[model samples]
Target: MTDWLSASAMLLAGVIVGAMFLYGMRRRQDRSDLERADLEAKRDALIARLREAPDPSLERDAAEVLRKLDKMGVEAAPLGGAAGGLKPAATQIKGFLWGAGSVAAIAAIVFFVTRQTKPAAPADPLADLERSVQQNPDNLPLRDDLAKAYLDRNNIEGVSEQTQYVLQRNPSDARALTYSAIVHIIARQPEAAAAMLQRATQSDPNLVDAWVGVAWLNAQAGDMPRAEAAMAEAKRRHPEMAERLDQLMAHLRGPSKAEAVHVTLNYGGQARGMIFIIARAAGVTSGPPAAVKRLPLSTFPIDVDLSAADSMMGQPLPQKMRIEARIDSDGDPLTHDPKDPGAVAEGVVLGNSVSLTLK
Candidate 1:
């Protein structure tokens, strides 16, 4: 009876031990599942954050989270075969991303260094002139030089500013007045130019160029008597120009003709230096001109009669001719370089003031 009691108690104790072992195993499994789910949720959250990350700071944080996930994956190696296999792949992906980040950092450094080593562009000549002018505003010679430079470049606004400044300092300045007259001529205001030229001569009577310009304008206006008087004055002021004055006189007294070609010159745009006007028979590209006149660019919008006296030879003038006006950059009447800007009027008739544009 005592042996039977012992066996029954041993069986009861075995049953209780077996039941406790099963419950502990189930509890451990539930904890493992909870840990895996938590790790997966953390990885998903890190991936989402990485997708919206704007800068390197968030990228680093995401990388760190990936490393932790990778470590957790290794720690949960016994959970399943799939979990164990994910460890190496996750480590490789992390290494690739780190390499890419390092490369990007290196590229940024190279780009910045290259930019720092590049050379700057050269300074502009006009800018240098402007700076010098600003530094010495009262220098009249410098101002005039700057004004001339502006005129050469056809910069009307710049020319006006510099010339106006010089004029303000000395209103009776002959040179400034002449330059202003030139500007007026370029602007196609002949009356204003003539006034300025007149003022320039009045301020200084001995100004030979001014006197010559006056004579030329008068001749253009068909006031031959006034032109001759102005020419005499120019010769008196500078006797060395007597021969030139004689040649101009001869041109003014052109050979008599039943009908002479009349030309009215008009400037379509900006013009400077000298102008060479020629009348050639239509289709005659070479040989001496039928009539020719060389005048300063300032004498534009002027009417001139072309007759046999303007002819290079003593022969009669052609009936049918084309008139050409060339802006001579070098002031050489003998040259008609194709590069020089010019204009031509075809089918021109004698005894008629045919208007033409010097482009």
Candidate 2:
């Protein structure tokens, strides 16, 4: 409350100063206008009196009036008198605009500097989730969200702790099963991971992660039919996973003989971001990719591979396609940021290796 009052007081003082300065400038201009009018009136009266009486002193007075009026920058008829009498008038200022910038600068400095500079506490992104879990300890969804958040941050211990908590309470929790399966996989216990994933899929058939895990396990076992079935089911259930399924399928199928694509980037010390190696139908630039591969953000001179497994909707690419290598600034493929370094190669063949330079 005290800080607020001090800030308000400073703001009010600045406004009053600005108002006074403007009012003073206006009053000065009004005084100049009034003085010019008074001088012009005296000059006219002197001229009329001199014409009637033929007075020499009044003629001199008329000339003096003209001089004073001229000095004030108001033009009027000159008196017929001596030429070499007074010094030249000083140069007049156009307006008070010259002082405006300085006054505004000072005001801005005060306006910025007067406020308290409180040091902001660094934000914890998962604070809300943590608090929610703390308040509702029995909420499984909150615990799941907190677990995912921890997993994203690579807090492995936190992930283990949360998943254990949930599974201990409800062993058949689908999401918790998926999280445990992932933990098993990371621990190099593939059999245990497979069992957990299978249970997760049985518990929740709509769990995309369980379906993906099943597909990956089968594909690695060379059971292409089961893998393809799992993928087909996932695509039918959740179409948004098509891009990822394609990429996963392509990678599991291994590199093709005639359809392999190798893209080399000649990146010259630019911003590091996720690389999107997208293949579009020939002459097409809009919409999703015919085939795409995403590489991790890394240093310059990165190599990328794109093949049929990366194709959307389990489709094969045409003989020729437009291959675009883009370093997505925000990792979003749909939106393009102009700052993202990119290169395009037209009419690239399926088996060809293309070299691109990012700018």
Candidate 3:
């Protein structure tokens, strides 16, 4: 989400800066045009006088003056259409446009490259998993990546697909069970994740991740005391797991840490409308992404740090995954509805996947 926002902000800034630069250049050219016009008028008057004069000496002086004026006129002609013709005017306009476009392109490229090279946002469990999947899509370890991304994003569409896939193989996979519980919890299903975590813990107490997941769920329900106890117990039983447990505690205390995802959504071809970004758990009913966040839009597409507890099943996210980036209209600034304000723009896709390295 931070990645999407940051990219959007950079794009907007580039456009504004480019526009300003072009406007300034045009103003300068306009001023030059006016000055050239005045000079041409003076040159023309001198030429006319030289042509009408009769006295030999006076004619000679006028001719000399006319020559000087003609030379000055030639030099200034390019600035206006005086004598340089339409070709010069067209060339000047073309050069102005090309120069402006080149500068804008260079600046935009620099900004984009910088954004991509930066580290990921804070550790969003969902983002981490997405990262993992992107890094190792074929590496089976991230088989659960898509599901987790959707779960974290609260995407209601593909939960069943993800859960079904996971359970099909590891019928008793703790991660799958925990996610199912999370689905219930997010759906307001009343301690669904807790119940699953409880069963999983009893069946396999060593599943520290499951314990962490339960603790987070409890914390979300305002059961702070229960959440703390759960985390403490997990830490005590597996001292080596204390680090992971600590992360869970922090996340339950507030929003999950942000994970940076440097992204560029080029809506290839002639597509219309602006893109709307949203981040919801994979299985929830949350609406599309929006600016409901408190931060200014300009601060987006930034790196967000995420804690370990931000993951889907209390496990680290795989890597990079393509979170749903809804391509829609960005309506008028004065209007509120962004979904269908009736405006559209060209769309281009710059590779449909995140570039992640597999372990």
Q: Tell me each candidate's TM-score.
A: 0.35, 0.42, 0.32
Relative to the unseen true structure, what is the C-alpha lDDT of residue 358 in candidate 1, on a scale of 0 to 100? 65
Q: What TM-score number comes out for model 1?
A: 0.35
Give model 3's TM-score versus the native structure.
Answer: 0.32
Root-mean-square deviation (CA) per prediction: 26.3, 16.7, 23.9
Candidate 2, residues 223-335, lDDT tens digits: the string is 88988888788888889889887777776576675676788987876575578888887899865457666677777687766665555323466688998988888766656
How well is each residue in 117-223 modelled by candidate 1, as lDDT tens digits?
Answer: 86778987777778889999998767777776776565667878888999999888776776677666444355887998899899989876567556655655568
Top lDDT model: 2
Model 2 — TM-score against the truth? 0.42
Best by TM-score: 2
- Candidate 2 lDDT (Cα, 0 to 1): 0.73
Whole-model alpha-carbon lDDT for candidate 1: 0.67
lDDT of model 2, residue 144? 91
Task: List where candidate 1 sits over 4 angstroms from the true fold.
Answer: 1-135, 145-161, 186-188, 245-359
Residue 108 Cα positional deviation in candidate 1, in Å, after optimal superposition: 44
